[model samples]
Target: MESLLELKDVSIDFQSKRKSFNIIKNINLKIDRKMKYGIVGESGSGKSLTSLAVMNLLSDNLSIGQGEIILRTDEEKVLNHLSKKEMRNVRGEDIAMIFQEPMTALDPLYTIEYQIIEVLRYHRKMSKKEMREKAIAMLTSVGISRPEKIMNDYPHQLSGGMRQRVMIAMALVTEPKLLIADEPTTALDVTIQAQILDLMNDLTDEHGTSILMITHDLGVILETCDRVAVMYAGQVVEESTVKNVFDNPQHPYTQGLLKSIKTLGDRSEKLYSIPGNVPTPDEYQELGCRFATRCPFAFEKCFNEEPPAFQVGSDQTSKCWLHDEEANPNE
Candidate 1:
C-alpha cells in the first residue's frame, strides 16, 4: 500500500554553547492511509522530537540536519521544504496533533465551545450556527456528558479526562486526515485511559484517519498499533509488526525492553532491567554504536564501527552487529 506519510532518513540537531548534538539520527518510518503507527522509546530517546519534526513544530534553535518528511495526499506530495506560512496552513487543517498535556494545549481563558468552534470555523468554512452545533456534537461523540454545559465550561473547570476529551474534540473538529497523539492517555486513570483509547480508535476507524502515536507505554502500542518502532539514543534500533516485536524482537535493546515489562507469576523478588543509562548525545558522538555503552553483547567491533540495518524479515529490520552477516555468519 502507498504511504500517507513518510519520513526518510530524518534527523534533528541541537546546538548550545557547551556542545552541539544530533537528537535524532537517520530515522525512517512510514504510515499508510488509515494506519495506526506507534513510536516507542524511553524519555530523551527523541520520540517526541521525531513527531515535532514531522509536524514542522521544532523550536527555532533546533535545525533539521538531513532527510525529508514527506506527506502524501492523493492530490500531491508535500516535502518539508515549504515556508513557515505554508506549513501553518497544512498543520491543523490537514494534520492535527493532540499534545501530551491537555491543559497546556488549551486556552484557559476560553470556553470549550469557543475553542472547538474556532477550529471548525477556521478549517471547515461553516456558518456560526453550524459550527456551534458541530462542536457540541463532537464533544458528545468523544464521551463528554451534558455537552451543552461542558461547552460553556473553561478548561480549568473540567476534570483531566474531560479536558483531554475536549482536546480530542477540538482536533477532530477540523476533520484532519492525520492525527498525531503524543501520550494521549498518560494522565488519566486506567479506566478512563481505556475509554480514551477506545474513543480514539473508534473515531479514527470511522473517519479513516491515519495516526502517528507517540508513547512510552508498551501496553498502549500492543493494543493500538499495527506496527512498532523502537528507538534508543535517537536512532531506531528495531521496527516491525507489533506481534513480531513481542514474539521475536531483534535488537538487544528491544529484547531488553520486552523483558523489562512486568509479567504475571514472574515475581523473582527482583525486577529485570537493562542496566546502565542511555548515553548522552555528546558521550556517544565519537562511538560507532551508541548503545554499546549499555548493551551486554557489545564487542570490540561494535565499539569501533557502526552497524548497518540488517533485514530480519519482510517487515522487520535491526541495526546491530549481531545481525550483520559478516560479523555473525553462523546465525
Candidate 2:
C-alpha cells in the first residue's frame, strides 16, 4: 500500500553558539494510509519532537536541519522541507494534531462551540447553521453527552476528559487525513482513558484516517497500534509489527521493554528492568550506540560505533551489531 506519510533520513537539530545540537538522527519511517502506528520511548527520547517535526510545528529556534518529510494526498504532495507558509496549509487541513493537554490547547476564554466552529469555518465553506450542526455531531461522536449544553460552556466548565473530547472533536472536525495524537489519554482516569482510546479507534476506523500515535506507555501502544517503533536516544532501535515486536523482539532494548510489563504468569522474584538512564543529547555527541550504557549484552564495538538498522525479517529491523555479518562472522 502507498504511504500517507514518509520520513527519509530525517534529522532535527537545535542551534547554539557556532554549534548544532541534535535531537533526532537519521530517522526513517513510513505510515501507510489508515494504519495505526505507535512511537514508543522514554521521556525526552525525541518522540514528541519527531511528531512536531512531521507537523512542521517546531519552534523557530529548532528546525529540521536535514531530511525530507513527504506527505502524500491523492491530489498533491507536501514536503516538510517546504517553507513555513506552505506547512500552515498542510497542518489541520491535511494533517491534524491533538496535544497531550487539551486545556492548554483550547482557549480558556472561548466556548466549545466557538472553538469547534472556528475550525469548521476555517477549513470548510459551510453555512453557520451547518457548522453548528457539524460541531454538535462531532461532540456527540466523541461520546460527549449533552453536546448542545457543552457547546455553550467554556474550557473551565468541563472535566479533563470532556475537554480532551472537545479537542479530539476539533481535530476531527477538519476530517484531516492524518491525525497525530501525542499521548492523547495520558491525563485521564483509567476508565476515562479507555473511553477516549475507544473513541479515537472508532473514529479513525470510520474516517479511514491514518494515526501517528506518540506514547511512552507500551501497553497502550500494543492496544492501539498496528505497528510499533521502539526508539532509544532519538533513534529507532526496532521496527516491526506489534505482535512480532512483542513476541520476538530482536533488540535487547526492545526485550527490556517487554520484560518490564507486568504479567500474571511472571515467575521472577524481581521484575525485569532496563538499568541506567537515557543520556541527554549533549552527553552522547561523540558516542556510538546510545543504549550500550544500559544494555547488559553490550560489547566493545557497541560502545565504539553506531549500528545501522539491519533487516531481521520481512518487515522488522534492529540497530544492533550482534546481527551484523561483519560483527558475527559465524552467521
Give the TM-score of each candidate: 0.96, 0.96
lDDT of 1: 0.88
lDDT, candidate 1, residue 110? 89
Off by over 4 Å in 1: 329-331
Tens digit of per-residue lDDT, candidate 1, span 264-319: 88868878889988877666655678888888888878888888788989989999
Clashes of each: 0, 0
Model 2 residue 179 lDDT score: 98
User: What lDDT score belongs to each candidate, Candidate 1 first?
Assistant: 0.88, 0.89
For residues 27-114, could you state the per-residue lDDT of candidate 2 as single tens digits?
A: 9999999999999988888899999988888897788878888888965465765777877778778899999999899999989999
How well does candidate 1 score on lDDT at residue 166?
93
Q: Which candidate tops lDDT?
A: 2
